[model samples]
Target chain A: MKAFDYARATDLSDAIGASGCLIAGGTNLLDLMKLEVETPSALVDITRIGLNEIVPEGDGLRIGALVTNAACAADPAVRRGWPLLSRAILAGASPQLRNKATTAGNLCQRTRCSYFMDNRSACNKRQPGSGCAAIGGINRNHAILGTSDACIATYPGDMAVALAALGAQVEIEGPGGTRHIPVADFHRLPGEDPSRDNVLEVGEVITAVLLPAPVEARQIYRKVRDRASYAFALVSVAAVLRMQDGAIAQAKLAFGGVAHKPWIDPRVDSLLVGETPSKALFDKAADLLLEGAEGQGGNDFKIPLARRTLAAVLAEATAE
Target chain B: MAQSPAARIAVNGVTYEFDGDVRRSLLDFLRRDLGLTGTKKGCDHGQCGACTVMVNGRRINSCLSLAVMHDGDEVTTIEGLGAADNLSALQKAFVSHDGFQCGYCTPGQICSAAAMMEEIREGWPSFASEDVAGRVHLDDEEIRERMSGNLCRCGAYANILTAIKEVMESGAKP
Candidate 1:
């Protein structure tokens, strides 16, 4: 809780124009600040910049970055159009945390890796080249896919997983200008540097998240946690499927708690297209989805758990 | 005094102007600056709902938010809900149902339940809600799912559930 100069941003320019870190809800930022994991010299409050609106764009919805998780989940348009987003967000945090967490902050959230949070531990994500303790230490909740020797942390947010499946686009404003990034490509894997979670450049302020037109598909977000609520996902699935005349018309799949980012593969959907929903088909697709999955010592259950979760989510989405 | 930045906030209808450290959380602001100790701080984090408070008609973990961030926002703590003489319906229900064995987490639980009830009234859906657009009925599963954030180590969940149900049935709002 070291003293940091605080300022309020009045507009989009003022927000991104400043040189300090932008804070909206302060749910995740403050936690890291208290843990000393993030110690910015200055903080720019962006909540007052009037970014809380949820508006309609071209055949889609544009959610302002400041909109709280609770508001996003309860929004009538979101519930009707992108029900998977609502369910995914609700699956992550409690009611109180949801009330304070914002859509943009959720997407920009850091991993819940215990080593990264502990300053004493040698975490490459927290301090590059220090070494990753989770690789040798307890790694039960570590990533199973897209992991490198540098870090094994998992992207813990549930909303991003659904957004990745729905093909959502992020609207960002920075010193360069405004740009849109696909949700699938927003987060990065641990190749050489695990410190960087997303492709957000420095001083880039997220403006809104644009979700495409309603997919007339059965959307489902199934999360398996150790506890019934208020727990991180052991392995989760966000799936959207459209069935036409006993055949699959369109399919979108994203897996969470299994990789450095929300695991989304177009081939899973392509493999299922024009095919009827069945256990065998789902099992085959599940195997294909976990093809390159490699579990650490303690997280071996995630392989089978992720497979079952994918199959179960597919079955639930296609259930008559 | 460190002469830190000052923020303005209205608590339970009374506006208070106080100087707060930039790093001080809303929970500390209410407890230390304004002396509103009724809102207990358990974990000093968002995990435990013991620091729950109502901010602009919504329940939030006060410990997770900085005091300077909530400037001009209306906050309501447990003390605002009821008094010793005039107990709110939920307070009365808690008393009758024995909603608590140890009263440390009572304030937070009550505040959370109040805001949760309001959320349900406004058609807000919980994770357990079968239909998002359908009417929110106060059922056992719904109540449990909605109140799952507030933990009670005393194992008074049954009584807490009963108290919340009674208050809901009695149509309570604060």
Candidate 2:
């Protein structure tokens, strides 16, 4: 890794001004620095600021961005109230990884595109307008739902999918002021501007993530990946359903590893309301969500794979 | 090479203050700076668990963390567990069951195993967690699931599990 100045900041704004990038736990940033994927002029260590609290605020949780994935997953409040998120975090890399990885850093981590991995390869996210190689290149794991001509790389983590499904919100301090962005709106789709991933403007530091009050629903995070553990999902679904007398009262379905943002289908979810949740209803909702999935030749398999994942998760939501 | 960055690191009750680069990893600080060479580094990427260590009780990938970030924090490396004279139960069990070959990944594997036992004790669970909110039982499946992070390319998982099982049963300092 290239040489850089490091100092622990006393406050959030001070950290933003002292360094080019904020070092939460140094899990993702240090790896990239070693690989030369990320080379900041200076690193502001934010571990000392005590942003690691996971407390109940009003009816919801105010999860400090610095909370380790392990702590957040292990917290009693999270285990019972938000099992979807807990399971999603657990289904991630491994026990060791969850310790060093912070909630804010997990959301802020860059894409995992193979082309992006190789700096020599043309990746729009790595070098804006350099040209997207994953579009025509080997894209078995590339996105099919949210993409433009610029980028096709998918969001790699599973925790964010559950967060989006649970209606989480991110609190950030930027040049403008402290703003709370809805988790769904925080991450942008690859519409016209593919370079901009999160809506945070320049020099914005995330303070904490506020999870909205847990829904009175049966929630499950169903992830389908090649490996048994420590692997990214192929297509994962975070489903939360409230069934009233064999009929759906309300539902929230969001997908991961298939789109730029959480692939939510509230319309298809609406169909589940006031209806019995059978394989047929789940299949219909799965079909509706897959309508926007335009696959590259190599990733054409994901079109059906994603639908089945969603269907399976929806079915799981209906069961005891 | 750049100038070393300065931070206070307390590992296994030993305190250290050194100037190390911001980019230098916590693994490097432990092995190179403090000379606690028991910890190992396998894959520099986040894939392998060879560089595992404890920061304030929770186990994390040391390769992924910068040394200077952990100021005023208690860290525990493999060397902290036990030594030749007074070996931890897990260490002795490893010797009894022959849990290692090549042995490069032993330090990391041992450290990871130690922390996972604590995680289970606290009722923290995994994907296969039977009751999401209920008490988590640490069965074979639970052990395998929790210890999945540490990789022994030599395929000594069975012996490793045996060693851990002995330590859990014996209730020693491993």
Candidate 3:
């Protein structure tokens, strides 16, 4: 990795106030640095800035972006209150990774651009206007939903997808001040400007993510993929359904491995809200969500695979 | 030599100043800097579980992470799991169950198992669990799901799980 100034911040104020690129665990940052995808002149270390605390905020739990993946999983509130988040984190990489991975860094990690990782090809994500090679090249794992002609990269983290489903709020500190942004709006889709990855502005440091108290619903996070473990999702679903006497009260659905952001399809959720938990409900939601999915190649199967996963999760969720 | 980012990282109760390269992984710093080499590096791409360790008691892929990020953070590596003279119940159980082939992924396996036990103890549910309202149970399927992150090329999951079950059934750490 190329040399970069490493400075430690003292507090949330100092950490967020300090200049240069912000690094928490350096898991994602260093990986990109090694690949030369990120070349920050200086890195402001924010781990010891005392942002690792999981505290009670206004309406929910305020999870410091620095909180380790393991801590989040073991947290009482998270374990019981937000099983979707817990299951999502556990379904992610590994124990060693959860230790070093932080909530904020995981949320903001660069796209896992294979061509960008190669550093020799035209990746609009790595280099703006270089053109996307994956558009014509191997796009097997590329997105099938919310894609543009510019880019088709998918957001890789599992927990973020769950957060989006739970209506979590990401709190960040920028030149303005600390503000709460809905997790659903945090990441952006590949529109005309594929250069900007997330909604985070320049010189902004994510302080915490707030997940509201659990709704009385069944949350089932199902990620379908090629392998059983340690791989990105082929098409993952983070769903929560509130059932009253075997009838759906409300349902929340968000997707990963299909779009730029965790694809939160409330339209699908709306379709399933009044209906009973059945294959019919899942199929309707799948049909509604995939209507927007413009698959180019082999990714066409994800449309039905996503439907199957929804049915499976709804079946499992309604079972108990 | 790069300025070692070693300064008072409170690891597992004791504070140690580990001399580590900025580019060196948290796995390397734990194994080499502190002379606690129990954490092994399998693939270094965060694919393998050989470098598994607990940061504030959460399991993570250490190879993918840098050491500098762990400043003042608590780390519990495999060496802290009972030491050479002593052994954690899990460690003893692993020996009893013979959960090793080449013994390369054992350290990570134990660390991940310990962390997984803690997670299970905390009532965190996995994907395999059907019921979430009741006490989240860690059955064969749940164990397979929790321990799936730690892959043993030797495919000693059966024995590895037996060792974990032995420790769990013993009613230890209540």
Model 2 ranges off by over 4 Å: A16-19, B1-5
The A-chain TM-scores of all the candidates are: 0.98, 0.96, 0.96
Tens-place lDDT per residue, model 2, A1-320, is: 78776656776667553436677867677777887878787777777677889999988999999999988988989988998899999998899888888999888777778987788989888788889899889998889887899899888888888998898999998777889987877888877667777887777888899988887888888888888877888899888889898788888878898988777777887888888888888788877888888999888989999888877777778875
lDDT of 1 by residue, B39-135 (tens): 9889886887999999998999999999988878999999999988999988899999999998888999999999999898899988888776566
- Once superposed on the true structure, which residue ranges of model 3 sit more than 4 Å away at CA? A243-248, A275-282, A314-320, B1-6, B9-16, B30-37, B54-59, B73-96, B121-123, B131-134, B171-174
Error of 2 at A184 (Å): 1.2
Each candidate's B-chain TM-score, in sequence, is 0.94, 0.93, 0.89
Reference-based TM-score of each model: 0.98, 0.96, 0.87
Order of candidate numbers by lDDT, starting with the best? 1, 2, 3
lDDT score for candidate 1 against the true structure: 0.89
True lDDT of residue A317, candidate 1: 79
lDDT of 3 by residue, A238-267 (tens): 888787877878788888888888998778
State the displacement of the C-alpha of residue A103, model 1, in Å, after optimal TM-score superposition: 0.6
Per-residue lDDT, model 2, residue A147, is 89
lDDT of 1 at A270: 98
